[model samples]
Target chain A: MNGFGYLRPDSVHEAAEAYAAHPGARFLAGGTNLVDLLKLGVERPSTLIDIGRLPLDSVQELSDGGLRVGATVRNSDLAADPRVRDRYPALSQALLAGASAQLRNAATTGGNLLQRTRCPYFQDLDKPCNKREPGSGCGARDGVHRDHAVLGHSPQCIATHPSDMAVALAALDAQVELYSTAGTRRLPVADFYRLPGEHPERDTWIRPGELITGVRLPAATAGAPSAYRKARDRASYAFALASVAVVLRIQDGVVDQVGIAFGGLAHRPWRARHTELALLGAPATPAAFEGAVALELAHAEPLRDNAYKVPLARNLALDVLNRLAPAPAPA
Target chain B: MTSAPQPGHHSEVTLRVNGKPHTLRVDHRRVLLDLLREELDLTGSKKGCDHGQCGACTVLVDGRRLNSCLLLAVALDGSEITTVEGLGGDGDEPHPLQRAFLDRDAFQCGYCTPGQLCSALGMLAEAAAGHPSHVTGPTAPSGRPVPLDRSEIRERMSGNLCRCGAYPRIVEAIEDVIP
Candidate 1:
C-alpha cells in the first residue's frame, strides 16, 4: 500500500473539517473496502480521516417510533440488535447474508453503503473501466460481464452495487443522514445512489466533504412481514448473482402495502416502484405476484453473458413475495 | 480539524498483542497483519491472499474477529489483538481447539490453520452472543442462544479457506469442542 497521512478525529465536525481540508481525503471507519482497494491500487487517497472512534455507534429509537442507526454501528451488532431482528427481519437477514462473520464484525453501516462495486474490471488497474477512470472505457461491457449490471446501466458503465444491507434499506424506506460543512440533511435511501447515467465515476450524489452520519428507518413499514433472498454461485461467502428484498403487508386478503428492491442487477438498489404499484390493493394471489414481477423485469436489457440474471431476479422476487403473502387455499 | 492529529505519513501506536504491549512507529499504510508478523516478530498469523478475500490473516481485535490485512495499524491504536499464539493455554498446554484439531486431523498444509483457529474462536463468541448467520432461521428469536449445528459451523467459518481441503475435519474439530 502507498504511504498516506492519517488523522483520527474525535467528533463529526472534526471529521468533516478534515475532509474539507484535504482534497482527496477519505473517511476510514472499518477499512474493509477502502484498505482492500488501496492494496489493489483501485483507490489512492493522500490522507485518511479515521472516524471509527466517533460516538455514532448506537441504534436508538426516534420519537416517531423509527430507528436511528448510527453510522459507525458495526454490521454484526446492528443485525443482532433485538429491534432489528424482531421488527425488521429483512434488514437483519440481509446483513447476515453478506460477507462473513469477521467482515460483519468490522464493517460499519455507513461504510457498507459507500463500498464500491466488485467489478473485476474496476479492481484490475490494468483493465480500462469508466467507473474507475471516466472516459478511459468500460471493459466489463464487452468482456466477462456475467456479473455486471442487467438493469439501469449505461454504455459508460455496467457495474452493480454489492451491498446487501443497502438493498434491504431501500425496501424498508430508510433515509440516509448526511453531515457536511454547511449543515446536515437526509435523503431517501433510494435517492442516495446514482444510476450511473453519463458519469459512472460518481457512484452516489454525495458531495465532497460530506460525512454520512447515520440511517433513519421509518416506523411505518418496520413491522411488515419482510425477507431477503439471494441467488449466488455458492451457498455462502459469495456475492449475489441476483437478490430481492421484500416488505409485504396483506390486509383482508389484499396487498395493503409493499416495498421491493432488487440487487446485483443495477448500479444502485433497484427499488421496484412499478411492481409495488401493481401489487397494492390487488388480491394476494400467485398470478398477481407473477405479473407484478414481470412488470419490473420487462425493463431489464440484459447483456450477452448476463441474460440469465433476468430470470434469476424474477424467480427470487416471486419466491420471496409468495412466501411472505401466500394465496388463500381453495374453499 | 484542529483537534485532529497533524497530518503525517507515520504515527506512533501502542498495540497490545498476545497479552503484551508494544509501542512503535508505523506508516499509515501499514496494515495490522504486517505489524503483527514483521514488527512484533510473531509469525503465527500468515498472509495468504494479503487481501480480505482469504481469511489467513484473521485475528481478534478487542475480542472481535476481523481481517487484520485490511486494518491499518495506525487506526488500531490502543486496541487489544489476539493471534493464534495467544489462543493456546499457558506453558506447553495447547488450546482445546488445537487439541481437537490434532485429534481430528483438521489440517494438512497448516498454513491457514492459524486464521481458521482465530476465526473459529470469534465465531463461537458471536453465536453465543446471539449473532445470526446466513443459514440461521429468520424466525429464530433474537438474543437467544443459537444452536451451532454442523451447518451453522460451516456457514460461520466459511470465511476461512482451507486450500488443503481439510474442511470436513475442520468442521468436525470445531463441532467437537462446542459446549
Candidate 2:
C-alpha cells in the first residue's frame, strides 16, 4: 500500500473540513473497499480521513415513521436491525445476500454506497480502463466482459455497480444524506448513481468534499411485501450475476403500488420505473408481471457472452414479483 | 478536538491483543494482519490472498470477526483483537470447537482452521444475538435467537474457505459443539 497521511476527525464537520483542506483526501469509513484498492494502486489518496470513530453509528426512528440509518453503521448491524428487518425486509435480505459475513461486519453503509465497480479492467492498473483512466480506453469492451453492464453503458465504460444493497434501496426509494462545507442535502438513491456517459470516472453525483452522512428510508415503502433475489456464481461469498429487489402491494386482485430494481445489469441499480408504471393498476397475474418486466427490459443492450444476464434478470424479477403477489390458483 | 491525533504517516496506537494491551507506533500503511504477525509475533492468523476475498486473515475485532488484512492497524487504536492464539483453554485443553474439529478430523491442510474457528465463534455469537443469515426464513423474527441448523451453519460460515474439501466434517464439527 502507498504511504498516506491519516487523520481521525472527531465530528462530521471536522471530517468535511479535513476533506476541503486536503484536495485528494478520501473518507475512510470501513476501509474494506478503499484498503483493497490502495493495495492494487487504484486509489491514490493523499490523505485518509478516518471517519470510523465518528458518532454516526446508530439507526434512529424518524418522526415521520421512517428510519434514518447512520453512515458508519456496519452492514451486519444494519441487516440485523429490528426495524429494518421488520419494515424494510428487502434491504435486510439484500445486505445478507451481499459479500461475506466478515466483510458485512466491517463494511459501513456510506462506504458501501461509494464502493467502486468490480470490473477486472478497472482494478488492473496495467489494463486500459476508461473508468480508471479516463482517456486510456476500455479493455473490458473487447476483453473478458461477461460481467460488464448491459444497460446505461456507453462506449467509454461498460462496468456495472456491484452493490446489492443499493439495488434494494433504489426499489425502496431511499434517500442518501450528504454533509459537506456547503451544508447538508439529500438525494434519492436512484438519482445518486450516474451512468457512464463520458466521464466513467465519476460513479455518483456526489460533489467533491461531500461526506455521506446517512440514508433515509421512507415509511411509504416500508412494511409492504418485498423480497431480494440474487443469482450468483456460487451459493454464497460471490458477486451477483443478476439480482432483483421488488416491493409490491396487490390490492383487490390488482397491483396497488410497485417498485422494482435490478443489480448486476447496469452502471447503477436499474430501477424498473417503466415496469412499475405499467404494473400499477394492472391485474396481479403472471401475464401482467411478464409483460411489465419485458417492457422495462426491452431497452437492454447486452454485450457478447452476457446475453444470458437478460434472461437471468428477467427470471429473477418475475420470480420476486410472483413471490410478492403469487398468481391466483387455477380454478 | 480531543483524542484526535495530528496528520502524519505514523501514529502511536494501543491494541489489546489476546487479553493483553500493547502500545506501539505503526505506519499508516501497515495492516492489522501484518501488525499481529510481524510486530506482536501472533502468527496464528495466516495471510491467504491478502485481499479481502480470502478469510485466512479473519480475527475477532471487538468480538466481531473481520478481515484483519482489510483493517489498518493505525485505524484500530484501542481495540481488542482475538486471534486463533487467544481461543482455546489452558495448554492441553482445547476449546469445545477445537476439540470438535479434532474429533471430526475436519482438516487435511489446516491452513484455514484458524480463520474457520474465529469465524465460527463470531458466527455463533451473531446467531445467538438474533442476526439472521441468508438461509434464515423470512418469517423468522429479528432480535431473537436463530436456530443454528446445518444449513444455517453452512451459510453463516461460508466466508471461510477450506481447500481440503473437509466441509462436511467442518459442518459436523460446528454442529457437534452447537449446544
Maximum-DockQ candidate: 1
lDDT of each: 0.92, 0.92
lDDT of 1 at B152: 95
TM-score, model 1, chain B versus true chain B: 0.94
Please write out the lDDT profile of model 2 over residues A267-298, one tens digit for every residue. Answer: 99999988999999999999999999999889
Point out where model 2 deviates above 4 Å: A220-223, A326-331, B1-7, B89-92
Q: Tens digit of lDDT per residue, candidate 2, span B33-75? A: 9999999999999999999887989999999999999999999
TM-score of chain B of each: 0.94, 0.93
Pairs of residues at least 3 apart in sequence or in different chains that clash in candidate 1: none
* CAPRI class assigned to model 1: medium
Assess the local accuracy of residue B158 in candidate 2 as a C-alpha lDDT between 0 and 100: 88
Per-residue CA lDDT of model 1 for A187-287, tens digit only, reads 99988999998999999989889999999998855336889999899889899999999999987789998999999999999999999999999999889
